[model samples]
Target: MPDSKLRLPPEAVKKQHSLVWRIILYFALSSITLSVIVGMVLATWNYHRQTEAFQSRLDYIEAGYTESLGSSLWFYDETQIHTQVKGIMNLEDISYVRVTDNLNLDIETGTRPHHQDIKTIELVYKNKPLGNLQVAFDRQAVLTEASQTAIMMIIAQLASLLLLTSLLVFVVHRLITSRIRDMALEVNERIDSNSSEALSIPESAVHDEIDILIHAFNTLSEKMNNELKQKTRAQQQLKQVNSELEDRVEERTQSLQTTIDELNHALKALNKTQGKLIEAEKLSALGGMVAGISHEINTPLGLCITIHSYIDDHYQQLKSGFDSGQITKQDFSDFVAIMDESLGIMDKNLQRAAHLIKSFKQVSEDQTGEHIRDFSVKDYLNEILETLSPKFKKTRHQVHIDCSEHMRMSTYPGAISQVMTNLLMNSLIHGFENKEQGNINILIAEEKGNAVIRYSDDGKGLNEEAKQKIFDPFYTTKRGQGGTGLGMHLVYNIVNQRLQGDITIEKDCGCEGACFRLIIPKKLDVSDS
Candidate 1:
């Protein structure tokens, strides 16, 4: 399409008169018209003014001549009249002076120039009119002076008009016409496809509408160029993206398949490991119960053995006294008393050992078995504490179970027992490392159909690293000192995998020890195991 800027061709521009020339012509005509009007008005006014001045001069001459001429006419002196006329004729701007007698005789002096304005006054003596004095004024001298003035004025006005028109033409050509020509050339160049670079124009500090137009066109050019570049880049990018997308989709599909295979293998391994974990969990818990029970049983059994040894010695002394015939009634009485005391001590210690064994047996049975039964949560917590009592008895650490006795759960009691055992042991071993006096609190409550257990201790809280890996298998702070690390891991597994519950280490726990929050379902799904 042809650009609007090039709508007017060079030949057309030349054919069309430039605005500057037209304006100059119009200005010249207007100036000439105004000058002519002003010149005519000034000439008319000058004519009238000169006429008045001339009239005054004529009146003065008439007045002066009246006295002399009246005297001349009254005495009938024609020579004096002639002399006076000649005198009037010698005055400036006076072309001809004429004198006429009452007899109708006329006399004149000086030559008549081109035109004349004549005035007549009668000579009167003693109130009687004498011959009339006709004074004629020559307009030729005034016309000559006025003609000189008009010539000068025309010259000056013409010069000024010429200079102004020239300046106007020069300025208009440079500022407007030339710039328009440049715009046309630029548009023509742009229409040529080979010169399709973006248009650029030099800008002036001060600008007019044409400059604004140029700026707008430049902006459009820049925008089109940029859009074209962007279009090319976008097309390339789209192609690249399409190619890459196909490759990525293929790679990702292969990767996903591999990941699925790896995941299946991992899941199988995890299942196998889970079975071993269950067994290990059971053996570990049973071992702890056995150790605690044995510890407790040792004391009572030792006492019983001591009592038996004493009773046997006393019996031997009695037998010896009887054989040697050196025994007394007091010795027999002492022997009977010792025997009674020994029997009573033996019975009490045996009963104590049996009780310890029974408690261990019950705890072991519950922890190793995943049997679901209705059990009081509070009472279960107490039982686990009792079974683990030997571990804490030597320390000044206090463990409090804060749970409503009425709070019961129809879930796996074994899981509950094992979880509590692990948490207590974790606190004792990891939390209260060397501290004798510590406090452990277990708060159990029901919330939204789940038993919320908050267990914390007043011992050194877990560090950042420990908190992060606390539930990871074989990750223990006290690895060599029989930490085992499985306590918390086993607890996590039981609570999450078996008990169908969730547990979180609450960092904001208002205690100086690690706090574990366990949310166990009141009713567990036994099939999950």
Candidate 2:
């Protein structure tokens, strides 16, 4: 499917323009723009130079012919003046010249054009003004010469530009563009034929980008071809398996009825066994709670008993001294002191015993019954931990709880207690199995009207497989050990079904131990209950 998508469409290939033509068009436009600019600058410079040369000719005529013409005019020689005027006209760009004496005699040569520049010079000989000489320059003729030169220069530039552009186009097309077109055509052909043939590298003196592209394309083609071959083999194997399955189906039809009966019987037995195991797990949890509470209450009760004995013995001594009339003020004072100290000790131990019993009773009822009620999250968690203190007190493991004292929830405390019990047990049995000491932290907060409980342990963290199947029933890492594997499974059921909540393991928590997050509604709906 992916390979078919990778094949280029025919319309796309047809619509693609030739790379060589695009390059040529761009190169030609740039060349023409540059040539036009340079030609304008050169033509302007040539025009200015021609104008300067014309000015130089006028200067020469003023210096060389002015004195001679002035002498001829002073001598009143008309022929000599005419010859000088004619000679001046023969100079470049001088179309007309005239010389006149003071007596109004004039000699002139050449015809003046309409567009001409006239220069007037004084004719002087021996410090005497003879006449005024006027020279006319043809502005049109000078302009014409500059125009001709500019035209020739532009023509040569254009010719060179055309030749250079043609050469570049030819070389670029031959070296790069032609090879690319060939590769495209070959690729299109292979796509049409559904062939997996690798592209052929073109002949080149040096390896370049084009060669690299060919190598990469060939590698991709070979990989795709291998994949196609594997797919073909897989399809053939699937057909063979289908044929064999048909034969097996016919043979299995003979015992189909027997298998159905046996399966039904086995399913019933399995259900019965599962029910018993679940019941046993619950009983086991309750039994452990009882043992823990009993062990906790023993210390306070024993202390109270010893204190009671000491108080009674002291009272007897006081009574004996008073009855014999041998009790003095010091003895009475000592007796009062003994009585006060003993009573205080006894009262403290009795209070301790009462508190332990109260915690045990509350946790026990919550674990046994499915009653929903309002309770403080912090207080209830402490009570649950108190009941499980025996399991923790035997080891150096510590449990810490972080929750607001005022935070409350209206849900099944029994389900919550059971979930917590199973989690702590998992941490003890699996997470901190071989560790001498570990820390268990429980953080409770409210988010969006839901009680968010984050529980983590500072023990060996769970592996990938354990994290994946940790909630699956009968999926225990310790198969032969005293691991029921139903502890976490029961926790999953209680949180999801009983409490109508979600529980998930935090995989990327960066903790050295396992971490689990539970989110349950602070108040369960009637329907949920």
Candidate 3:
């Protein structure tokens, strides 16, 4: 089965390049296509003009041969004419000139087969027509000249094409591609090193298509620079305004802080007085209840003692009689049974009395106070913390103890124990309720003959409002959750009144969350002069 909680979306990454590459490709393709078409048309026209001129040359040579042959004739026989024409036929453009007679078929030519072309014309004298002059042009020679001319024409065409192509490619590549590449490289290098300089196009370049384009690009760049300067001006103004705004914000913050501090101090004084009043009230109530409970337990206890004493006297009398052989074995057993019943009643009542006394003593001590003891603060604090092991384990709380090694001071163990226990319980119950983990820190030291103990936690701490009143007696946030509201008050009483020390709490620094500080003197009411 596919996991329902698996992520099915793409994470953010750089996008692939598409736009700029297409532009470069389109520009190069268009240039090449335009160049090829123009080149082909010019080459075709050159080929046609060269071919027509060669054909005209051939026609002029043929006409000159006919007129010269018709000028005169030694005889009206073909044999003499052929002999005369062959003697004067050794020229370049006229490959061969031949006159052949229609009458004599023998020895009628000037090496007839050798001189290939023949212009046939009638030899006439004074209105008398002679035999025809037939001249032959060499088929092999004419075709060879035509082939060379064709080759030269093709070479000329190719040369022109090569020159034009090279020029176009270089102009487009250098005037366009190379220049652009240089500009791009310059821009890229500047950007890499964080330099802000405009790219300048090279001069000595004429007005080609790319030259016009470069001019446009340069104009745009200048316009952009101007706009950028305007933007920079606006940005500076915004920065100044922001700085002023920040100063105002800071002033307001300090004012708010002062107001908050005063409220905290007032609330603290109120809570201290309130705690004292409430603690006195709870103490009075507890004292009265303790007295009543003691009285109630003593009545039943006294009755059991009276009943046991009376029964003991009877048993003693019976035992004395039995030992003297003045009583029966049945009488002895009955007396022993009665004594056992009396002892049982007495033992049960005594146990009940002992329980009442222990509960009363514990409540009285916590409400009133505990005896002070001179002991090492480190040892005392450790004992209290260990006694809080149950609370720590239950709430999965972590504790850190940082104390000066080999430093010892005199303090009350019971007071510290009660104070530490109260704070730890408060943190575990309220601070780490829904948290994954929690921390409690215990620090001990001596400063100028005064012992100091500090305890804190990484759990959720008191809010701004709650921090002020959290130490107040009977002012509990855990009302429905079995909070007695007397825990911190009791702790305060134990620390300040009983132990003769002062306490201070540190609040949040506005970082990740709240931080609590507990600063206490190694000794109470000590001031540095």
Candidate 4:
């Protein structure tokens, strides 16, 4: 019995001690359940009765007040109609009352209920049909009454249940629980002292189940005592084996922890390396733009210089002719014309150089910092294209921008510039690889409070494999021929993370080229950035 008790689940032992309470609780729960079922049935019946009474009240109102209401409405007596509807509002469960005539005169009182318990009664005056009267009934009153009755019923049933449970607890404790509790206490004391004494049975008791239980317990106690003596020796041996195993497990755990720490360190290093690579890619693009802009600026600056030299030489000639007193009207006029033409050419070249410089400066600043500012989308795209004009000047690739002038956004323009730059560069380098001529079209529009950009190039489009892995870092078709493969990946990151937007390639775009679609919010939240 002791071994079996040890093997029994903890809940079984708890139930043994709480046997009396469990029985009382079971009895109370069953009684409460039966009471609740009866209460619900009574409440349902009362609710139906109340509903019928409410309907009868509506019928009474129609029979009693319909004629007076119609007569008041027919005479166009607004005061009388209002008075009659107000009286109707005083009835029980009547939430709202409204009277309307054929002349579109509407008189209503009280607030309408949310539930649709409305009744419409047609008004008739002297055998002629007038407008109708609408009465809205409140069903909450019926529910409230039913709830009150059920609550009272529950209170009465609970009182009866408590009385019965108390009586049952007293009977069960005297008859059964007291003996069981004594046995439990004796067993606990013996187990704590490692003794196997038999439980004491009542001397006056008959040889019933309780006495039989005591005999069985005594037999089990003797056998358990013998088993305990044998188990004591085996437990001592197990302790030594367990001690050795614990040391081996501790050593293995330490080795595993060391490997985990090394793996974590390696992962951190790898992530750091990846970040550095992404930064290097951005810097490389910036450096290329710097080189391109510098080369572009030289041409206009060179023109300006040549025009200045020509103007100076002509001025010297004009001064010499005037000093020698041999300057003709035609000569003077011709020198004026030459000076005018040279100055105009110089001014034009200088302005061209200045415009180029301004565009480069803005693009460079935006690329270096993530600043939020309001900018016209069309104007910004123009500025970006101007900075990239040097790349397209030699190619037959015509770039077109289609966007609304009023469309604007407040976001990280640097990220936008980077994305545009990468896309244009990709088109020029890979899309238009060996082709002499290609067309790139950019269409920008506002869609659902977001800026949508569709950029397509009429160059060699991507295949299934290339399209699938196009935005993956370090993936490029031109791996050996100077393709860093980070352009599109950078664009993807900028659009998704920085701009809080999405970009997708239009798979079945009718054009025989790659079409990339970008959807970015017009106004970015600071927290999102």
User: Over the stretch 160-200, how does candidate 3's per-residue lDDT look in tens digits?
Assistant: 65676556555555445555555555655665776555567
Give the lDDT of residue 213 in candidate 2: 82
Flag the better candidate by TM-score, 3 or 4: 4
Residue pairs of candidate 2 with colliding backbone atoms: none
Query: Which candidate would rank higher by lDDT, 1 or 3?
Result: 1
- Top candidate by lDDT: 4
RMSD, every candidate, angstroms: 25.7, 14.6, 27.1, 17.2
Model 4 ranges with Cα > 4 A deviation: 1-255
Q: Considering TM-score, which of the candidate structures 1 and 2 is the better prediction for this target?
A: 2
User: Which residue window of length 10 is worst by lDDT in model 4?
Assistant: 1-10
Task: Score candidate 4 by lDDT.
Answer: 0.86
- The residue pairs in collision within model 4 are none
- TM-scores of the candidates in the order shown: 0.48, 0.53, 0.30, 0.54
lDDT (0 to 1) per candidate: 0.80, 0.83, 0.59, 0.86
Best by TM-score: 4
> Please, what are the lDDT tens digits per residue for candidate 2 over residues 241-336?
999999999889868978999999999999899878877888899898888888888888898888888888888988999999988999989888
* Residue 103 displacement (Å), model 3: 99
Clashes of each: 1, 0, 20, 0
